[model samples]
Target chain A: MPTPLYLATAVAVSAAVTWGLRALPFAVLTPLRSSAVLRYLARQMPTGIMLILALYTLREVRPTAWADVVPTALALAAAIGLHLRTRNAVISVLGATALHVAMSTLWPA
Target chain B: MRGMRARGGARDFAAAAADTASVGLSLFPLGISFGVLVVHAGLTWWWATVFTAVIYAGSLEFLLLGLVASVTPLGQIAVTALLVNLRHVFYALSFPLSRVRPLGRVYATFALTDEAYAMTAGEHARSWSGARILWMQALCQGYWVGGATLGALAGSLIPITLHGLDFALTALFVVLTIDAWRTQRDLPAPLLAAASFALAALLTPGQVLPAAMALFTVSLLIRYALRHRAGSPAPDEHRHPVPAVPAVPAVAAAGGEG
Candidate 1:
């Protein structure tokens, strides 16, 4: 097997493990009747998680490739535009990704 | 208790479900891109696809690329992803997802994604049909499987350029944020999000996420504080009704069984 294949295997395994961890709360918590505290905590989770996810992704992008920021910004604009007009998630994400990709390919590095 | 939507028609509901499936389809590129990246880092497609289908969380999926490349132990990777996705717990609290057709815990948690969260978050605001929610998850997962598979195979066919992949997440967030802003009338949300993100960006170092989380936490706290002082409005109360907003109810009416 190639070196990439080894990495792929690790990734696949990691993904599985990660998914299992995520599913734990739902499996464990969903069945149980929740207390006020449980409910309160669950309510607070998304924004923090989402912020972490988005910021984490941005951190990896090289700061000097500031030009790359434009396509993503445009993609966000496209996603918002499509979503507002259509109220559809698939279209919004796809349109944004495609447009962003196209822009990246076209933009001078 | 809000049961199934009273006005949603079967056809519209199906259409909406189909629309959801497409969202998953979009995930295909992401998944495949991830798979290809992993393989390049030295893994196989099987492992890549499995992870894409199994782990399924977008941010964590990317993060896994780094962990795997560095030879991090599986246990360690698991622990980190769990911590990263810990925030999803909050999502299930208020949304209809916790009530989504119980998929034996594993499937429900495995399938959660930003798109999944966004879709279900909107659904929770309106009703609690576990079946509809499950349909969305299943469809999204399907796209993930297909996308990863194709991406792994095409890894060689496509040039090995990583040009625009990184920005995809930002675009996705921007899109979702805008969508949330337009649908609801509450100005506090976007305003708060902007203020928080900007401040977080300024204070954060090379890593923007923890900073963003700080901002998001502040926004949520602000909202939570407001709720305590003003009493939270009914979900529908925050919605801005366009004078002739037949579209809102029309979409819902055509989309439900009840």
Candidate 2:
């Protein structure tokens, strides 16, 4: 086991670095917020970024197995459908999540 | 006036809390998993608390357990963190940090996770106060930290059958993506995202996320340049009319989208 001092140092380093990474954009973007480039990005990037994030989250869901694909697809459809119908994010997330958890448990893939 | 202000404050708090309930439910289970992992990795429960409180970034915190257990070099940890979280730079492009108070903005910036960004993005966030935003962020952090602490303390008692709870994050992202797509109706955005994911997955499977983001950024810039050359007005120009003399600063407009 590492010494207590070393462990403390590790935690501190991790905290500082993590916090710094989170803070970097804010510091860098404060000055450039008004630039035409950022303006364009502000308007155009949201949809693209959200898309990227959703796909990225599902990157590991290979289609080799029905069990692997079915629950997630169904849950995603449920989420979309509920959101489109209710226009409530909380309901969509919760309802879909409950369905996913139940499906995963029942199917046991 | 004071009574009215207090009531307004209560209303904002309630709204912010209500808005984050789904996220809170999702994060708590994940946080518990993180706590269990930290302890399993040979660290104390307090370490989980520290990680949750100080780092606050979910995926990075998960990775940190292994890094700490292996005693990875600080420089390596810092570099890994920077790459893992590089997407936050993109999030900052449209995050309404400017609307928040200065000191609150600092904390807001620190707490701006993927869930927080997703919750606050699009048209709904435009009318949110700095108070509501800050409150929402604080509640998120609270859920994470509280859950981590609980897991660390009673991790052994928790059953191992909670297999698919992690899907909550993915589901939340899907919902947010749908919301964003509906709000913007920008068809090429999803296509570009797919193209970026394909390129990144094919070329750099290990680093698919960052690679995908970089590819998307480049593709977006190219599309923007093309549109500019074509003299097409911005899609959002109608929603936000530019003043004759520039009354609102660019930063104010930066919060308009993304």
Candidate 3:
């Protein structure tokens, strides 16, 4: 074993887990198709979970640090604003990431 | 009969390629960036190919690049994978896998990536075949894997170490949040999410992700019950076509057998 896992094990486990998640909805679609509760969840969970997931990614940022906070906040705003304007995921995400990367490297956090 | 079958397959292949060309062009560069990031994070180049080839979940793979470099417990990795990929479980609600011939369903489901789903599961895909959907997904994966391999090969030869690269994941989630909100025209859901997550974080301290998801799920169920009691279960503002365009019906169509 490669300590935590053999290299192949890590690959297989992640692959298996991902495949299982992707396949799950279809596997159970017969029963799930008629459930109103599941229907509500399908409508509700994406936006809700996505918001939480974004926050989870940023959970560690220190709210008090001006240099980091300013850029991080601005980057998020720019991302959201740019997406609203363009309705394009690629431009908004890449453009915001590029702005943050430049700031972190040149402007310095 | 043979000639017609051959021609239909060819046309399906070409149409799928054309439908995916623009998306594929963008996927290539992002895949390259993923490859470069993997090497910069000190994982071997083969790790990039193995991950893109096998796991194939784009953002989760980025998260895993960090985990694989550390001694993060395998149990945690499994949980993280579940949370990150949970959205796909819903994508299946409207994904055209049911239209796919039974034998192809397994591979089709395996490759049901965000890119693949976005391309294939929409109002326009009503007439698409299992073979066409399969091709679109395979091409998307090829572009991703090819770009990642190229990026790793080139990245390994260079000495660039970029900090704050992890910000890509944050940017990605933000994009998804905005899309999910726009698709549903649902503003309150995100507010409820913020509240649920904050409560979970404060109350549980550890186990925030799963705890928050559970809290959010409960909140959704409560909201659903109230709406049902109130009569008519959908928000009024959601009367506008769920998609501004045809490309985003997965959530809107989720309440159906289609």
- Top TM-score: which candidate number? 2
Model 1 C-alpha lDDT per residue in residues B72-133, reported as the tens digit of each score: 77677656665566556544344444344343234655666667776655433355355565
lDDT measured at residue A108 in model 1 versus the true structure, 0 to 100: 51
**What is the DockQ for all candidates, taken in turn?**
0.29, 0.47, 0.51
Interface RMSD of each: 7.9, 4.7, 4.6
lDDT of each: 0.57, 0.75, 0.73
lDDT (10s digit) by residue, model 3, range A20-106: 878766656644545657656666666777788788878768899877787789889988999889977778777887888887787
Q: How high is each candidate's TM-score?
A: 0.70, 0.85, 0.79
| Per-candidate clash tally | 21, 0, 0
lDDT by residue (B116-159, candidate 2, tens digit) is: 88777656666788899999999999999998888887765554
Better of 2 and 3 by lDDT: 2
**Candidate 3 regions off by >4 Å?**
A1-5, B1-29, B71-76, B114-129, B164-166, B204-208, B232-258
**TM-score, chain B, predicted structure 3:** 0.74
Measured by DockQ, the strongest candidate is 3
Q: lDDT per residue, candidate 3, B1-258, as tens digits? A: 999999999998999888777566556767888899878877778778988999998878887887877756777888888876766776765566655666677788788886676555333566777788888888889988998898888899987755555566677678777766656766777888999899988998656766787888888888888888888747642564322122333343333322
